[model samples]
Target: MAGFFDRFRKPEPEPVRAELDQAGYEEVLDLIRADHKVPAVKRIRELTGLGLVQAKDLADAIEEGRWAPFPAPGQSLADRVRALLSQDRATDAVRMVAQETGMTEDEASRFIDGLDQP
Candidate 1:
């Protein structure tokens, strides 16, 4: 004597969402996956004393082409001077070009100096 009322309930499907940005942690993870020859993340963290998140962010920026990785802070002034010494007339030394380009010597030095360093 049961009633005909208990046989057709269906479950709802979960909503789909877009991929979330990796921030930095995920980006470092991606880079590690790409190149595992060296423990780069570990070394970088040790040298910079940056937190896991910051380190990862920097790594991500480098990988994404949003930032460049060169001209480490401890580089010598001689190297900087050498780079300025090597430029052609169009791209001469930072101080020399700064006068014509209307850019600050410090700014030009940093850019050209960085290129001079390894």
Candidate 2:
């Protein structure tokens, strides 16, 4: 089963590790810190200007305790979607869901629509 899934999966991206100035390092640290509200990928992009896969790989490494990014960026995907929807940003929510889950627009729409069910 693992082999089967691996065949379909995108090859893992190589990790990113950028040297940063104190202020720059601290900024990413704050973003990945236990209580920070900024998204990990966003912070990585801000610091290193890496593309999404690289940024996410770096963020994952930081999250695994290599860089004290432990408590993880204070928000979960569901919460983010809810936040966007609460702000009347359904389109943004759909776009975000599609990007994160690799779903088609129709599938992401249906997924978001599920959140509205009681």
**Top candidate (TM-score):** 2
Model 1 stretches astray by more than 4 angstroms: 1-34, 69-118
What TM-score, to 2 decimals, does candidate 1 have? 0.29
Q: Write the per-residue lDDT of candidate 1 for residues 19-52, one digit (tens) a residue.
A: 2232333444455557841354554465556556
TM-score of each: 0.29, 0.38
Per-candidate local distance difference test:
0.49, 0.65
Prediction 1 global C-alpha lDDT:
0.49
Error of 2 at 13 (Å): 23
Best-performing candidate as measured by lDDT: 2
Error of 2 at 4 (Å): 56
Expressed as tens digits, the lDDT of each residue in 1-118 for candidate 2 is: 7888888988876454564444564566557666563485787676666887776776765544334221227877677778768867687667667766789889988998888522
Give the least accurate 10-residue stretch of model 2, judged by summed lDDT.
63-72
